[model samples]
Target: MEKSRVYFTDMRTTENSNLQKKLARLIRKAGIGNIDFEKKYVAIKIHFGEPGNLSYLRPNYAKTVADTVKDLDGKPFLTDCNTLYVGGRKNALDHIDTAYLNGFSPFSTGCHVIIADGLKGTDEVLVPVSGGKYVKEAKIGRAVMDADVFISLTHFKGHEITGFGGALKNIGMGCGSRAGKMEMHSAGKPYVIQEQCVGCRVCAKSCAHDAISFTDKKANINHSLCAGCGRCIGVCHRDAIKPADDESFDILNQKVAEYTKAVVDKRPCFHISLVVDVSPQCDCHSGNDAAIVPDVGMFASFDPVALDVACADAVNAQPPIQNSQLKEHWNESGDHFHKVGPNTNWKVGIAHAVELGIGTTEYELIRV
Candidate 1:
């Protein structure tokens, strides 16, 4: 396979070019403008940062990307699907509120923020996954699947489950609707946490499949009737409903790749990952840990897989921070992500993406 080209630019800022300008320069150098952006509805997929998680990309960076898209005559909208987890981003209203609270308002990003899934997180489009082993059909957010062009602006960091949350995770897991995320993360249906149930019946009201029942003012779930849409999990105020996190770490990674292919397939796609704030887990957490490694550069590519691999390679080459998790496991594995997450081999998703013909693992890193 021919090597895909990945572009890089360091964090160093000169008096002339700030980090934002450098980011614009880097993407342009990587050929982001080569796509036909004129009057197209472009979806810029990004994480708006779970409230209290300070490590996610700033809204300023989003502005630069959005402005660039506008300069190319594209109608850009910043977007991310509602989360499957009960948090500040579980529904469209909460998701948009969290975005604005985290500084992603239309006034800041120079674009609108759309919760890709609708109000309850049930609005989804099931797209067939080509060459998929785990996922035959991927349930992506309707707004995400409706884009004329797709772009992922990812925050590259270590994940406890995926080894690393790079471009593949951003484009795949980040774009999935609530149920789509459940399909990737769980192998079984949701069950009520009996201890946490408050007899509120909110879970029952949210269950369209008649899965919830109450006994002694506590909730119970009928798995036979459950579709595992994960709506009840998000609706319960007490966090009573919980999905079984039974999927193997490696299988979860493969499913993410399959979903990624479902979203980016047959579309003009571009990926840019910022390897800063290299946190030790997903930004889905209400908080983030210290950086595992010093800030690395920005990277961009047309191939999501190659872009992730290139970002991983760059991170592994850097020295670990003294106070973070990577420092303790530095001697265990040569790969930085693996050192942080023992079970999650990030390579699994990259290899699976290659097998699914999404992109090549081989890449040429051209420093900007």
Candidate 2:
């Protein structure tokens, strides 16, 4: 396979070109101009940080991308799907509010914020992909599927499940609607923990298929009717709903890869990974720990797999931060993320993505 070109720019600034300008230049150098942007709906997928997480990508970077898209005559909007977990972004209302609070407003980024899924996180489009391990089809957010072009503006950071969250993680897990996320994270079986059920009927009301019902002063999930969308779990204030335990880590990784393919299958997609925070866990966590390593840099590519591989290599090259998670398990030349997340093999997602023909791991790092 030919080496994929992954463009990189360090945190260096000259009088004429600031970091933002450098970011734009890197994007162009990575081939953003290859796609026809005229009159197209470009979905700039990003994680608007959870309310208390301070390590998320800044809105300033998003504005740079949005402004560049506008210059090329494209209509750009910052987007992310509702999360399946109980949090501030479980529903569109709270999700939008969180984005606004995190400074992702139109005034800040020159782009509207759209929760990829609809109001309740049930608005989805099922996309079919053959030969997937767990999911033959991925239930993706409607807005994400409807977009004419896709761009992943990802905050490259460590993830407890995937080892590292980058372009693939952003599109696969990040773009999934609430139900889609459930399918990706676990097998399609959810149950109610009777002890945790408060009989509030929130889960019952939120379930689209009437799979949940209150009985004997507790909520029960009818697995037969439940599509395992995970909305019920998020709506339960008591944390009563839980997914089945049979879902293995490998299955989750494969499902994530399939879902990512569903997202970028037919689109002209560009990927940008900002490896700054280097957090020990995903940005989905309510709080970010101290960075495990010094900020590496920003990476961009048309190939997500190559981009992710390149970014991971860059992070591995940096010396571990003192007193951070990576330092605790420090092996001079070992994979720091894998040590932190022992149960997960982060390479599985990227490998599967390559096998699914999304992109390649072979890459040449081009310093901008």
Best by TM-score: 1
Task: Please give the TM-score that candidate 1 achieves against the real structure.
Answer: 0.95
* Structural similarity to truth (TM-score) of each candidate: 0.95, 0.94
**Model 2, global lDDT:** 0.88
Clashing pairs in 2: none
After superposition, which runs of candidate 1 have C-alpha atoms over 4 Å from their true positions?
198-209, 234-238
lDDT for model 1 comes to 0.91
Tens-digit per-residue lDDT, 1-368, candidate 2: 78899999998788888989999999988889889999999999999999999999999999999999998899999999987667889888999999999999999999999998888777889899765767887889999999999999999999988888889899998888877887876765888888878798988888789898888889988888987777776566676777664667777777888998899887789999999988999999899999999988899999999999999999988999998988888886778788778888888888898889988999999999
Identify the runs in model 2 with alpha carbons over 4 angstroms from their true place: 195-211, 224-240
lDDT of 1 by residue, 323-344 (tens): 8998888784588887788777
